[model samples]
Target chain A: MDHLVILPILLPMFAGALLLLSGRASEGFKRSLCLLATLLQLPLAIALMAQASGGLQVYAAGNWMPPFGIVLVVDHLAALLLLVTAVLAIAAVVYAVRGDDLLGANFHALFQFQLMGINGAFLTGDLFNLFVFFEILLIASYALLLHGTGSARIRSGLHYVLLNLFGSALFLIAIGTLYGVTGTLNLADLSQRVAQLPAPDAPLVGAAAMLLLVVFGLKAAVFPLYFWLPKAYAAATPPVAALFAIMTKVGIYSILRIYTQVFGDTAGPLADLANGWLWPAALLTLVLGTIGALAASTLNGLISYLLVVSVGTLLAGLALDSHDALVGSLYYLIHSTWVCGALFLFAGIISRCRGPRFVGRLVPGPALSRPTLLSGLFFLAAISVIGLPPLSGFVGKLLLLRAAETGVAAGWLYSLLLGSGLVSIIAFSRAGSTLFWRTDPAAAAGGPVDNVRLAAVLALLLCSPLLVVFAGPLLDYLTITVDQLLDPQEYARQVLSMQISTSGGGH
Target chain B: MELLYALTLGVLTMSGVYLLLRARTFPVVVGLTLISYAVNLFLFAMGRLHTGKPAVLGQVAEHADPLPQALVLTAIVIGFAMTAFALVLALRAQGELENDHVDGRGKR
Candidate 1:
């Protein structure tokens, strides 16, 4: 009932619409408006986290009842993600403004719209409404991806677009089937009702689940379905790619939400079917994504492949189904989003200096040597991403290992995860060695580093230690989040109770 | 009557899969559209179609399942939007790359 729950979505949407309407306004105004809107959202997101930490809150739109109306539900897990997403978004917008000199007035507008779509997707509880928000985000991404529309970008962006379109189509079909069988789109109500279906309806439900898996799998860049990710990511401008980093995680969040909350009990034949095949699929995804990362040479390509690896790790975590595994996966998810996003931004900075052809090679020499301070910061960030000790990345990996050990599938998955981590370390080291350590004679001729770009890099670099220090509380928060996820009846009751209270009062 | 719906599902699945497997982006787009149509129809079918009865409840008759129908309407709109975006992106790619390969990344 409170405004806090919906503002995270509404603020960006209103900002985006305003930016579009004021498209002819000065760039300063647009930038300030975007910054003000994003800055305003941070406090709102914090307030939501505080409210949700106590219990789940569901807001049914337009005063409509469930199983019929669209709902916006925020549990601890969703709230935590919303908070993380908001923080990353703020950093990204700042970086975009500082680093991307080529960005025009329309850039801010598209960026706002993209944020609106992302927040909307996370907040919505209705399946169809989820699709609506997804489209809003995807359309905005299409424009952002093709901002400059070079041949390479257009080629890669198209691949990203077509593949996602296929996924969206499948998503539609899945929603259709689920609706036909369950006769309801409300997630909270569906969670309770789907389990009560007759035996004959099992296949239909299974089909729907499988279709959904495919749709989300593509979005998450899962194995055999991740062919479009690496190049598309590599070709985009850094800020755009940084935003893209959040996109796949959003897909993962959806999968986790739907699989556990809406379809919690996989009993009887369908349960057996999901368990038998899904885990193996996860295994393949983990292995393939790791191999791809190891093989890639370019910085952008390397980070792109790592994204695939991270997706694999997440899938493996879900497949194992241990609380430890879930915690590890969640931890890894946060670490990867920040690390990968930072790296992409760094890659952009490097590319700006050495040109796009600078992959797997350093500048000819130390051209911008005045700010020894900036290089020091970049070094810390780079080491952190490579999972060196006393940083967030290392702690996340440690949790994953610990989680893997607690499960029966750990014997094999643990080894795979370990191997993947090693490969990732090596891949990152190789890229770092080429980009940061290598001293090319030609690079020395370039002028001093831009202060704005240096500041953005430093900001990200400073986050490394904070992650390590705060790991205890972060882990506790995730544990509570997982507990809420596992037992969603609490969520359902909260929503239903709220509805009864409001209806009684209104009448 | 339900058998007819099942047969249509088979046809839709076949065509959609066939189109999806094509190398060209346009065909894939077409295939996706067909699949979406089939999916919407199948979801509608799940409510168990009744002869001479609409979903609206009246004074004298039992209402068919309103939930699936309402859900289908939403799906249709989303499906159309997805298709439109995909088509525009595809056309843009074709213009930019001078090729129509659905997998636009150069050499995998």
Candidate 2:
């Protein structure tokens, strides 16, 4: 069990180091190592999920106890996210290894390091360690985002880096304030201590929460903080961009973790003062992100907007916060990651066949002479993203709306969610019409699709319907996970009691 | 001492925001650096200023909160890496595009 806790992070970190040290290694060798590492993670993540479902597991490093040492705790929620991350990572790695001529040995090394950071962020029980994991991931992403170094990529990558740096700064400030007040950085320890603080200290907590919210909001690409995302995402290569689809969700995951565990139900003086203020901000995010998606003209830009819609949905879910809504949010997150990643891969294939100039031009390409498997795949992924029935995405939205309707805030939030869903459907339809239906004369003259890229698109396309069929059991599992997260007393007790028992043995 | 540190933070943040809003890429890079420094100091200050207490086990007195210091150290290294990457990107953009506007689409 302890080995399961460490394997996800260690596997990637070790692979990354080996790849980096074996400088100038053959691209074939590096690709095999990357695939091997990612494939190995899939089973390990499954085992971690099974272990976490039984109860929370905590691993303290160097035999040091909590509050004095670093620990990695795996709750059900973390395990689910780790599993989703592994799936997306494996897909992205496979696609990169197969098609892209530019994806070299060093790229695989950076990819593995990025995985390490992401997994560590999800698994760690310490606040400082989370920050460390974030930095590791962000730095790796910075390099990967600029891997090809084109004019557009470089320009967008700079904005991406600067914006995240700002978010990182805010995160540091939040950590500082949290430490200043509580004198501890261990998350489980802080969760207990934060509940004990007096009324007068409420302002500090609110300030800290707001700061952290802003930081994560920026990362998550919520309204007012999301301007950099579309351009940055659009500028990167397809495989890199596909992996980045999961990056913003990491921010949402952090916010969910902190709010549920650390902040809990204690409104404090400041929360009461700011009563429901953040909800309006969240509403603005929902509307603004959807509108942005609606207006996007290019295939990549449109997908970027859809990513924004996913964030909007997650935020709306947070505002509603019922059990069903939380489950909806979790399900939506999983559905969106798969759909968005698949869409981007398909878009890459389309762009390759049509060339950059043909995109969004509404020009008809050559009619499909044979079985157009990629087009079918793109259509399925698009429908799933739009939350059409008989798809995994539909199940998530149905549950989300069901959950939202039962709340006191239902009157306004329900309408907003419904409106957002409609706009998303229309936006995705427009992208599909332009991409699959419209054809350009030049593209028509250009011959058949690249076999390898088309194959990658087909693989992802097959995944969407399968996800829809499995939604029932997956949702049940997620619901139980969310329930455990909502009441983490068992987790808190295990951590604290472990520390006490270990210290008793030492003395 | 706390007041001075707070003032430094205020100034850093203000300048960083101003530079961040600038149209050019170089100033934005500079602004990010200033902001990073302020953040590092801010995180370091969370341990509550005690001049004599090092973040190490000693024979005497109380120790500073080594956790925040450790966290800040990682932040600083990561910050440096990101900053260097940003600079390289800025250089690349200027080399390839013949312009230095932070946003690729030009002055908006």
Candidate 3:
């Protein structure tokens, strides 16, 4: 069981390599191979999740000890994200199998590589390794974003690639500076060294920390750095966009992990280095993202902006920096990732139904073929996104609001959060009415929708209801996760104290 | 020696930024390359300006740091791949739009 911790990373790599090498294979063969690998991740993630519930389980690569060799740490948060990634991979692959994969060669291969990168990023305990995994995921994304290239995708891809290249440069610079000052790239080791840092190194470390924030900010699609997101995501083929729903959260995850574990409250003078910038950034991101959603010209555009809004909300949850808030944010993180994915998938369907002439354009064209079922699903997803009751979004928001309880901070958070919800309601409503209500009764709806794609969309959207049903146990798990996260001392002790039990044949 | 190294990195980065801000794809690619070169140098420098020092420990009293060199190598490889990809994509964009403007707009 302990050995299986690295499977999440290895499985995808092997599958991806196989898919890539099987260049001459039939479409059916490729699709089944990709689907089978994706499905297998579910049980693997669940088993890891079960194992992680006990405590921090570390897997030292190549039988090396901590602070020396690379380690993969599995806590509840990492395992939970692994499960989310698996679920999303399945939904995305299922959708892509229908026809999108044919748009470009190596689609399955690229998809699996990206998953491997994402899984590695989640599990890796070394800072340098994190950067490597980030590059892997990013490079894969660069190709995937331009897959099924159109004028729109190519144009947008150009900007996306360049900006991210710059971002990557910043990331390397940051990692270098930290390694220079600390002499170690291991997270747990850094936690201890940072706590006892001599006074002179503070400024350099502080600068590096902020640089890291900027890099992650770009990835998370936070305000001011998020210009690339709407165009890139909206222009992508639906399955790629759906899979990308977790990409920004990877930034959020890094922020959560690094801030809590490596530079938590115990780090002498650097105690709250990031919180000050983070809090205001989160608020501004939320406000601007809401407005962007309201102003979107197309349904895909609207969904993309809604995603930006989710990033904002989740950031605010993190910025709140309280245990209860963290739990709420974690729950919201899961809910938003799944819901945004569902919305992106649905956006593809909506565009298809309206035909090439009205591909995702918000204005009405023709009535959809499956008007009732489609509209119902859209309504549920919209309500969930907008934080309406009997859905997961409301529960998430309620938990956050409860955490904010009565103060100047509380007031600000409440208004901003609730205000964003109102604006989202307006945005989704306008889109719904424009696309669904104002449809032309006489015009012909497009070709019959693919059943497999529709089923994939349904599966992702259904996570909203599923989230609500299981919210109680999920919140409890998150509470423990947060507690684990906040205790940097414990994490450091546990990780650094780990000894290599299986002695290799050596002197 | 340290001053010369620092100035070289600074100049490279300065030119990189300048070209990066240009509206054309070719210059942007050049700019990215130059900047990556600067970053690699900067990363290498983080290990300090050591001459004739062994990187391995327990041999010499004063040893150089080997970690930053490894990091720089990884960066260079990644930067190479990114540059190649960027060049291909730029070419594709140029052919598609028949212009080199980064945003696919009229020649600026």
Per-model root-mean-square deviation over C-alphas: 3.0, 2.7, 1.4
Instruction: Encode model 1's per-residue lDDT on A1-507: one tens digit a residue.
Output: 665788888888889889889978877888889888877877887888889887777777766766567778888877777777777777777777763625533777788888888888888888878887888898888888877657777777777776777677778778877776777767777666666668898788889888888887888888788888888888777778887888888888888878777666433345433444557777788788778877886767877887777787777777666677788878878877877888777777766665544532433334434435535555666566656687887787678777777546777777887777787777766655555556666543434566676566556556667778888898898898888877757666666555533645332
- Candidate 1 has an lDDT of 0.75
- Tell me, by DockQ, which candidate is best: 3
Candidate with maximal lDDT: 3
Alpha carbon lDDT at A18, candidate 3: 96
Give one clash count per candidate, in the order shown. Answer: 6, 7, 0
Worst 10 residues of 3 chain B by lDDT: B99-108
Indicate the worst ten consecutive residues by lDDT in candidate 1 chain B.
B99-108
- TM-score, prediction 2: 0.93
Instruction: Please give the distance, in angstroms, between residue A132's alpha carbon in candidate 1 and its true position after superposition.
Output: 2.4
Off by over 4 Å in 2: A101-105, A266-278, A359-371, A406-408, A442-444, A450-452, A499-507, B104-108
What's the DockQ for every one of the candidates? 0.56, 0.78, 0.88
- Candidate 1 stretches greater than 4 Å from native: A99-105, A265-278, A356-378, A406-408, A442-444, A500-507, B1-9, B55-60, B104-108
Estimate the TM-score of every prediction: 0.91, 0.93, 0.98
Error of 2 at A208 (Å): 1.2
List runs of model 3 lying over 4 Å from the truth: A505-507, B57-61
Clashing pairs in 3: none
